[model samples]
Target: MTPTITDAPDRAEAAALLHAVADPARLAVIRRLADSPACVCDLQEQVPIALSLLSYHLKVLRAADLVTSRRRGRWLDYSLTPDALERLHAALPAPPPRHPGPTAGAGEAATPQPYTAACPPQCADQIQ
Candidate 1:
């Protein structure tokens, strides 16, 4: 079922999601899944964790909706849900706005200006 977030309580749901992905192991699992769908065994190999431990982490990720799993024969293949990444991306803080600094010829204390050459221009008469 699609989760609609038209109400304020839904923000808790978003926070739960962020909490789930905050784990380093879970983050690694998401990165691995981003490349290709993998079974638990594949996840174990990629992450170097015990099978039981990996299973627990996968459960957490699944509960947070960051990943989905489907049984293929005897193996459960795992993949990242695009929506989860989108939600996390939306929660990120925006970059700060840039302020314009002083420019040349503005007369500000910090303004940059080029120094003129000390040599004077020579006319033919002056040269003679």
Candidate 2:
């Protein structure tokens, strides 16, 4: 297949997404929102951080489009975006082979490998 062309701006956007979820606090919030939409009160209880901090985390998530905020009466409800995980998944490079697949021999046992991808700073450089 022809190589996929990834421009600098696209890499930067992906890198920003990587940076947004890099924090444990932010990651926790994402997991919570993935299940259902919730207000600050709901998120604050799920995470140990203070309400103010929770708001900050939500801001970061919102910026990355990982979550959406909607005004509901007196509360602000947040929900995970439909394609958030997909976008993040697409940003990383495909995982490398764990152990070389079945050798030249026929009917050789092929080891099973779980999918694993990494998105370090150099990951952008690898973008085709």
TM-score per candidate, chains pooled: 0.66, 0.70
Q: What lDDT would each prediction earn against the true structure?
A: 0.76, 0.80
Question: Which candidate leads in lDDT?
Answer: 2
Clashes of each: 0, 0
For candidate 2, lDDT tens digit of each residue in 73-107? 99998999988877777667766545546562465
Question: Which candidate comes out best when scored by TM-score?
Answer: 2
lDDT of 1 by residue, 1-128 (tens): 33445556666776787788788888899889988889888888889988888899999998888899999999999999878767666545445444445553344344333333543554433543
Clashing pairs in 2: none
Enumerate residue pairs that collide in model 1: none
